[model samples]
Target chain A: MTETLTAPAPETHPRYAIEIDGVGKTYGSGDGAVTALDLVNLDVRKGEFISLLGPSGCGKTTLLRMIAGLEDPTQGSIWLPGRGLDGLGFVFQRDALVNWRTIIENVLLPLEFKGRRTKAAYQRARDLLATFGLAEFEDRNPWELSGGMRQRAAICRAMIDDPQLLLMDEPFGALDALTRDDLNFELQALWPDPEKTAVFVTHSINEAVYLSDRVVVISDKPGRIVDITEIPFERPRPLEIREEPEFGRIARHLRGVLDGHSARRA
Target chain B: MKKNPLAYIPMQVWTIVGIFAVWQACVMVLDIKPIILPPVPKVLGELFGNFGLYLRHGGHTLGNTLIAFAISVVAGVGMAIGIVYSKFLEKTLYTLLVTVNNVPKVALAPLFVIWLGTGNASKIAMGVLISIFAIVIDTVLGLRSLHPDLIDLGRAMRGSEFKVLMKLRLPNAMPSILAGMKVAISLALVGAIVGEFVAAQNGLGFVILSSQGAFRTDRVYASIIVLAAIGTALYYMMEYAEAKLIPWHESRRSHARPTAPSKPAKGPVAQPVASDAKA
Candidate 1:
């Protein structure tokens, strides 16, 4: 496991999009305080797809929230060197679409918030919806759609702003296996463009392997990075890639690392 | 697609008609005294005989209710916004509002009449006092009930606090605020009647009391009927407004029946003949 795991290269003039430096987060105060993340350092290069894979109690979500600037780290800072905070997009486990807004309006929320509702923006929103197969349901209320459809609309919304960084916290965790597989493919097609970066958090090792270029495994209860392994799969991976021998090897390797951490904690 | 118009009548209307018929029959069969319980026809006659008097008093009561209801809505929504936006107001003003709401406005009616005089002002004050609490509580709940993830999305987009409040919080709170308005409107009517009972020159409440003093039970029954009609009218008016404003809401959608299935349409098609020519 140690041989396969490699530290991120320290570039001299790094064009990193997001750099987390020794970040730590603690909730509450006095004796009741709980540490969520500690000494977490990672560099997400421009256009890279990374996954934070950990158990439920691990601070994977907290880390993602910190990067998105929704939560503050108690000890360290997340630096997006050149990009503004506005260049961040987030997709939560829940679709979180406003019930009152129609599907098209929900997708256009960020643009509306910025007062950028030009004709071009509208066309772009419609095009994104069409790509995600939600164009027919544009006028319908968010509650009228099925769960998978709502999640797809939510992803469309996050991408509408063309953010430099996309932080997704188990976006398909609530979905069934078939729908999850479908969305995983859609997400793979949507991300890793030369202009955008994505950091995904998931508990499923297969999901992390299938969607990510690099998988950062974290330990439970006060999360800290345990191993960072680069997947050697080529681009445009099919569903059949999960059946390949190398896919099984990497998944078993991740499971072994997770089991070792659990044993030590016990 | 067309259907009978009678199907549009709600079950509630049938129940009301049945109640009136039973009351009329019981009065004729049992030989009950008119003073104790007037027959439905006598009450109807009273209502028609002095229609001008009932209309005048009914108008006064309706005016007072509408004015007070308007005032309570503005003040209640304003206070709710204040509480939602500021933690200080949530802690202090919200608790103060709940404490004040617990004191019966009926008990305070005489004080209002004494201070503001027995004109429309006192009655309107009483209405505002009685109805404002529910509006405030419900609107505050609605504004604060936004999903945290939605707010996070807004923040990630670098939306200003005012933008979030106007675009996200207020629109999301509309259904709940409308629900509160329904409760408040009814309470406002009660408050106005209570105020008229304490001291008033004219109103359905004053008519009922004056008729009771003169032992004109039929007129009392007539006035009671007018008050019930006013309450029902106001409630339905609010319902109409809610339906118009939030057609997407579940409450409005529940009123619609599923549409009929459509027949499949025929289209031109190209058929490939069975061929066995492989080159």
Candidate 2:
């Protein structure tokens, strides 16, 4: 585990927690050309909740994959400032929770992966399940749990190792609107400590507007950020915040950008 | 279970009565001799009269079948793992296995008896030979058909191939393994009985052969019925075990729950968390 670096009184934010500079992903060579994410550059700041919002083929998942080290960027560099990314927790688009493992065991998977398989680690897992309101279903398999609870268990799994940089790809896209809103609130409640930075990728404009501190809108295929909008919402956001005029305004702006990008392509 | 256990007894009674009625009708109506298809009551008397001798032979045959089944299962699973782990071994050994599988082990049972003697070894060998191919093919398919994404997830977690094999591949391959085992169990029975027909002093196969030689047709029918019952028992036991072990598996789950829950959700919400440099 890397210790959090401190700067004198001023908030010395991570210049770029992830500096994705000139990253490119080309599927095949020669006549079969498919550049998924071309020369993509984005800098996520420390403690900033940034959402990579884009159209269907905008390479949002590709960008998230590069950040998570699941896929290597063909062109550029991605770095974690202050700490090397040994503690980066990744939540994939699909739940990816091992179906055979029970809810609490699933939560403890990261610890198991790290070879920290001790009684104390197990205690921590139990505590996490309780904290996340999954205490009643600790022994239930992923298949037995409802969709929202399964996702909650997946969240607990990702956070078990206390990752500093959490990368999620369309985590709530599959949930219904009400569940998604509830999860957004749950996410706000579970926000990492001040030093932690996160990057999220999603297709929903409202989801981007509701959750992120900064929403980076990207263009169509061979994705590049067309605009970076700073969210001006106050901390401790609630479900009712979605009904707020400013929230709707930001959402509308994002929708406009997405529509414009699609129009240009058409 | 929905079909009552006693239903078989009643069904058997009806079948025996109906067959006996037909035999009796032929004897009286057509004035047929009792030699070709003997009187029903006399045949029944003959069958019940030699019950102890039939049981002794049945036990021998079953023992041979069981021995063959156990050996085939172990050898099959071992060979499957070998094939899964090594490309060279798979390429070389798989061809030989398929070739051996195609050859009729029963045709060579006489030669096997000459080499190993007309004792248990020859019968066991025949049974093992018959079932081994089923096990190998099923286990290999099970080992190979593991989900690639699951493997990728394991790799992403830095789990070794051995760990993945034990934790993911083996468990996932269980249904296929059981399917193979079920087939192997039936084949082993056939092999055992067939081997007995070639050269066996004991076993139900020998009993059937002897009964036929003595022109005791009813005794032969009784032995055949006992063999069928044993085969059915073995198959049902395998099915029961499969049900007990993997209730979450789709095949088992369908029997467990008629209607499953819809819209299974997958994972957690995105949150900004401290990235552990050593995660």
Query: Evaluated with TM-score, which candidate comes out highest?
Result: 1
For each candidate, report its DockQ versus the true two-chain complex: 0.23, 0.24
Badly placed stretches (over 4 Å) of model 1 are: A1-14, A29-31, A263-265, B1-11, B250-279
lDDT of 2 at B19: 73
Candidate 1's DockQ: 0.23
Native-referenced DockQ of model 2: 0.24
Docking class of 1: incorrect
CAPRI verdict (incorrect, acceptable, medium, high) for model 2: acceptable
In order, candidate lDDTs are: 0.84, 0.75
TM-score of each: 0.89, 0.82
Candidate 1 TM-score to native = 0.89
Please provide, for model 1 over B115-175, each residue's C-alpha lDDT reduced to its tens digit, 9 standing for 90 to 100. 9998999999999999999899888887877667777877877788988998888877788
Ten contiguous residues with the weakest lDDT in model 2 chain A: A1-10
